[model samples]
Target: MMHSFGELVTKFTSYFNVRHFPMAPSTLYDPCEYFLGLGGKRIRPVMCLMGNELFDKITPDAYHVANAIELFHNFTLIHDDIMDKAPLRRGMQTVHTKFDEPTALLSGDVMMIQAYEYINKVRTNTIHRILTLFNKTAAQVCEGQQLDMDFEKKETVDLDDYIEMIGLKTSVLMAASLQLGAILGGAGDSNAKHLYEFGLNLGIAFQVQDDYLDAFGDPEKFGKQVGGDIVANKKTFLLIHALDVATGAQKEELQNLLKQNEDDKVEKVLAIYRSCGVDEWARSLKEKYVTVAFQHLEDIAVLSVRKKPLKELTSFLVQRDF
Candidate 1:
């Protein structure tokens, strides 16, 4: 029943394709194409268009702006892969790992520039507003990434701090995506602001869900290594919960699990996490965020018909497997 939002995005992307590269381009173009071609949920752009449609019709004008969001997101991914030293993106070779770090860096930079170029396709006034939003979101994303990296070295990251970090690192772009869509579709300032809040809340919930999935999800349905966050020593909800709840030997065991280098490290960590009830704690946290997200959606004040597709899209996003 059209479970994949990327299917809609794939159908729409052909129209956004533009030819701007100089002849016989370097390897930079290859990484751009490689990462972009390896499809994703396209939740951001779809929300953009849906936001636009809430105020006006979806047309070519909307596609350019929506596509810019996609470009900007991919730009972030390429740089993030390098920063994370991640070997795979969407289950395939990462740009930095497949090519080289230098190539990936240059390609990521080009993608950022290309994102601007895509935004410029809109008219002059829209370009000004869109670029302003894009610039702010890009900078904030970098800030968020830095915070995430910093948290890795830290021992006491609170829930509030983590939320703020995700807000900058992940949620702002989503807010911008919806605002851009609303702006493109001729929404009033109030409506645009509300749509942005909706996107922000949804983004937070989606990220929290990712954390829950890392520790509690069925691997067959989730389509990745379970307890991956634990294995990588990533600070996720499960880890955070354990930090808050475990005491004495349990704390020591968790700490030891975090430090251990073994073949079944993830399995061992999950066993401990389950025994400590971190899984249930994390699940409750995920649900809390999801409830808040839907509350924001309800407060959007748009007509129900206008909001239906957007709500459907958001439901598909947070409920999806992997």
Candidate 2:
């Protein structure tokens, strides 16, 4: 039976709500539970379930796979919070802040190890491939994070370099989630590859939209600090593309804005972004990647009807405020 992304989200949330850790070390397990309770959209795991249902009936194994994917995703978030020194996540205290860094680290470690245990529960014939993909994607995510940190120290980051970082940091895990689910659903190698490509492109588009929203969306609707990226001087689609296409005084003005720590910095930078048409470019870039993603989804050898949920999911992701 096929399921829309929303249906799969409800199904996955039930399984994900359980305590996956032991009760003993409250310092460790309590933080894990608290962070899990923060309750994200469950996008990655639900994508996994949707991938599975697209090819065959939903399997118990798919839930296990989804559990592992989500646990790992949250584990990354814990570490990301620590690295960013983020005090809040989902509008609550971050794991490191509420508990302590050491305890949060241990909690994240347990979550990651438990993710592997969930993976071990899957009885798919493609188990080895699943293990390999999971491990590789995990490392790529770390590599992307490292690159992002590295870029922060540099003066100028190439637009291409920035793209590579987001693809590694943001896109690979999402790509692997779909491929892993597809493999479990009896997808042949070619079809699985197409699905992976679909996810990779979709993830890039998602990041582009996220970066755009951080700069331009309503702080109330977007639920994030507007111009947060500019404040951090983070490398993003708009800033990087503005650097690439801007010229002479506009280019010089942007570089100076990047160096300034002032109340007017966001407005000044956004002025340049509008002048250079970076915001419009970001929308087009997001759509470009989403279009490519759906084309790959089309290449998957499933009945056309089976493709609807994925198409809807992609549309929802890219169409959000951009």
TM-score of 1: 0.91
Candidate 2 lowest-lDDT run of ten: 313-322
- Residue-level lDDT of model 2, residues 175-250, one tens digit each, is 9998888888888989999999999999999999998998889888886779989988888988889988998899
lDDT of 2: 0.89
In candidate 2, position 187 carries an lDDT of 86
| Candidate 1 segments whose C-alpha is farther than 4 A from its true place | 1-10, 16-23
lDDT scores of the candidates, listed in order: 0.78, 0.89
Models 1 onward score TM values of 0.91, 0.97
How many angstroms is residue 106 displaced in model 2 relative to the true structure, after the best TM-score fit?
Answer: 1.5
Error of 1 at 71 (Å): 1.1
